[model samples]
Target: MNTETNILNILGEQIKLGERKEVNFDVANLHTASAINVPIIIERSKKPGPTVLFTAGIHGDEVNGVEIVRQLIAKGINKPKSGTVICMPIINIFGFINLKREFPDGRDLNRVFPGSKNGSLASRVAHKLITEIVPHADYIIDFHTGSSGRFNAPQLRIVKHNQQLRGLAKVFGAPFVLYSKNLNKSFRTVCNKLGKPLLLFEGGKSFHIDNIVTNTGVNGAKRILFYLGMLSSKFKVSTPKKDCVFIEESKWIRAKLSGMFKASVKINAKVEKGDLLGNITDPYGKMNYFVKADYSGYIINVNESPVVYQGDALFHITKKLIR
Candidate 1:
């Protein structure tokens, strides 16, 4: 083997600077008496710089983020100018293959961070990510989408008090930025505890890909890399045409009655209180229940699925723009 290949032995895999290398992370599969190897891509730069990690498919059905990472790799993003870019296009491989949101064990991987080695499937996967993958990065981007049947306006969801993370969110240049509260056992919460800068990108919807959402994610990622001084001028970072609007609070409009939902307003539409957002009708179209906004804000997420149950989240509204 050559010198570079010899180095691969040290890293347990052969990878070269400016070239894409695939690493299969082994996770135990008890039922099959085998191991599930999650695929990871690492692209290193010849010059030294900070390492940034881009992860997608935390919810396996969210395909737009996965596509964003794939496009980045295909478009020569694998060749960084000064730093390492580690992309895990599909982190929830089991869930991705099953087209489900959670692991086969019915556990949400995002909620079980810094997990135990001998825990459940989700916990084990989380353990591997926190231990083997996340520690090597200076910053992290966890990509997501609205849950299945819902669509979100491309936005960055960050903590309300972290100025550093807030700055990074602006650099991401998403049209809408939400200062969201951290959830228990979430990746965001763990990162915050570790004092790592981790930003969550939410857009599009699960099980499908939208061009606009994918473009926003891809461009936003490039902008972040440029801001971090990882990409040189040759990469051509584009400036945002408009300023990002920040919202500190958001509320979800829920269905009053179970029925067939038909949305009248789309994602990113500005609305006033009592505005006609959508209507829920019975199966035979005999009864119609008009759903109205409870607050004056922008629509960041809307349910696209036709069927909904009573109390089901139908629309997500953010507070009026501050800027």
Candidate 2:
């Protein structure tokens, strides 16, 4: 072990690998009638060690994760170090351009896992990703943010069944952790089945940059690199609150009345059963309707936009029914 460490140190000191300017993993024709291929490459290290894959913009509008990946790539490139970083800063170029959640053909890239060779554009992207990259990753970090009309506190999303995922979640150093059992057909789901654990970090509601939440995410990924022995200590990391709620079941509370919304509760606020969450008021300022929680829990995500109609998802509350 000592000899290996010394060798790593020597190799690290002597390391010199230039970052690739372009790597074509798959071919695509641009809108200008020119043939182009999507680029994906690993910035390799001189020292042989673990390789981590950082991906973002699976849903183009979710910008924080992309920023996190881009920032890390820049850091790795500017300072050569141990291990390797394989990055794909923009995964969904179509959605990125359109600023939509789904692909150009309206396919959710997250749902099309281990995708087909001869399928839609989303499927082809997924297929190329899984085939060319994931198999080589020792650890994975995929970034995500809340979608349209929803706001989420910076948190880690992990499946309840996997302890490896849980361990990785702690490395993130976030205040909350959401147990999303609905990983079916998702990128993390397929990877878990293949024995490659991934941490799906979520924060900063869609289309908006929540500075506090984003910084938490940006710092969390950098902290993980240190914890994984991939980088030397360069900054002081805060002691993350381990007092996270283990929510096994998270459900959306629907608005019963059709009217403009008045959100009375904020994200991360705890509420008891039957507690008044907020209310809906008609445009005329009369005919007010009260919305209440069916179970006691904390508010992780809430509808930010005020104008809402009947059956609009108002709150995403998570109950600690199971540990």
Candidate 3:
């Protein structure tokens, strides 16, 4: 489908482009059952500007944002003198070849949103990837980490009322910046109901690779492509605080009485309103069960699978929620 109009979001939905490198390279239901093809890539830049998309492993064990988009595609993009840069490293190849993190139909591709095209098959592949790659993107960044057993650090989670998307999440520095404030149903609420502007790089976990959340998400996506001029020089990015201590509200503290667990607070600690965040021993510790912190923010995430079950999930509190 190269109608002489540049080639980047390069997907052939109705089917066309051949020498494929995989981007919307269909296969949803063409004969059998073992299928998975959702790829996209673009790099345009003969001037023009603004169009920076960069997603990754939509929860297929959050592969460090597919290594932070191949470290910004090896820092090239050939001609971005002004704009354009799209990528989708790995949307979920059967939950990344059974590495497992949801999406082999167990569903959870970012809670399957903005989808439909006759739904189901992960809602028609998340509605043909939000109608063929995020409405032509002009700012979307979804790369995560912190799932498998659980671990996060290089932060930068926006949705806290999008103050310029939390000033592009502190120029992607990553030392802890988790504002977050979406009422669930994500993909950052389907790119905030179409206005686009999105960002959610939680940082390192699941199968591991935490070079400070991949160097603060590859230099915060090239300091947001040089703060959106597409690049003509721009690289300081990292003041990291737009008052970002919101956490308007949050919840999830399971394992009410299981077996192992120890946590005495670590992953970004800062508790108080009850503080104790650790306990649930048995196998030989002769029974214990502390784990308290009913209120007072900043534990961001917990649970490293030291074996537990009475309810599973251990900590995810954010209090004062943000948004």
Candidate 4:
């Protein structure tokens, strides 16, 4: 991730210190040969510091993440006091354009990392990202949202026992820090392999934007920048309203019967065993089944969809906490 004191080369462009550049990360053209532009916004200070990269919209439907990164640029937060701040607000331009989560071919861009140049369209983009962009990043913060109709409390996800990540997660100061393993072939895994520190933020749900979630994400980014001495002088970092809850383990509560669903509780709600979390009912009103927490814990995720099928995850509850 090292770069020269005077020059930073990204996507075949040489950006000097104190220079600003908006480079397009173009991969392909549309069927009509219309070129798609994936803009990479870069800001560099004359003084030397760490290069932090902010990214979002790997999944097209995850608009909340996109909004957070957009706020950073629009607010001039990406202009660091020292070093460089890179923003690629939308990576999967195909999905972002089509309003789908995956590539036009239905492949998850995240699942194909360190991609091949000669591979599928998604793979080529991955390859370009890993090869062309990621090498310049000393730190990376990737934003994401819950899939389908699941609403997630603002949180950071990192594997357990990595002290570097553990400290950075605390610095980011999201509401919750969940210890999860890096999935193989994922963006996190690839970045980890390349020795780039990454903080993965998950909030809200797909195809939706929440103001609170957006603020949490934006504030967390500012905190990290402040910690790194990269935040501009004009921006003020806010103290987290509460201490981060470190979840050591968690489990998903699944639906026992398929039916109309309604959650009685909200995300981040702490519940006791047997507490009524929600209920399911037949459309005809002939049957109603109360959903209760099987064990005492905090709810990190709640399925917000009105209708669900049997065995669908209803809630994600914490099983253990890091004291």
- TM-score top scorer: 4
lDDT per residue as tens, model 3, 18-77: 212335546364235756555565656555556677888877777878988877776653
* Structural RMSD, model 2: 4.7
Return the number of clashes found in candidate 4: 0
Tens digit per residue, CA lDDT, model 2, 1-323: 11122121111132224333345554356667766454554665556557677888899788777777767666653122556666777888778767888987899999999898898888988887887677767788888888877888778888887787777777777768888775667898888877777888888777776777767776787767777666645655566655555667788998887888888998888888999989999889669888999998888889987898788889988866444
Q: Which stretches of candidate 3 lie over 4 Å from their true place?
A: 1-23, 26-53, 63-81, 96-142, 154-170, 176-223, 226-228, 231-239, 242-267, 270-277, 283-286, 289-301, 304-323
Higher-ranked by lDDT: 1 or 3? 1
**Which 10 consecutive positions of candidate 2 have the poorest summed lDDT?**
3-12
Give Cα distance to truth, residue 283, candidate 1, Å.
Answer: 2.7
Q: Provide the TM-score for each candidate, comma-separated.
A: 0.92, 0.86, 0.38, 0.99
C-alpha lDDT score of every prediction, in listed order: 0.84, 0.74, 0.69, 0.94
Q: Write the per-residue lDDT of candidate 4 for residues 1-323, one digit (tens) a residue.
A: 45447988788899999999999999999888999888999999998889999999999999999999999999999999988999999999999988899998889999999899999999999999999999889999999999999999999999988999999988888999999999989999999999999999999999999999999999999999999999999999999988899999999999999999999999999999999999999999898999999999999999999999999999999999996
For model 1, the local distance difference test gives 0.84
Error of 3 at 41 (Å): 6.4
The root-mean-square deviation over C-alpha atoms between each candidate and the true structure, in angstroms, is 3.7, 4.7, 14.6, 0.9
Model 4 scores a TM of 0.99
Q: For model 2, what is the error of residue 158's alpha carbon versus the real structure, in angstroms, after optimal superposition? A: 2.0
Better of 1 and 2 by TM-score: 1
Worst 10 residues of 1 by lDDT: 1-10
Q: Please report the TM-score between candidate 3 and the true structure.
A: 0.38
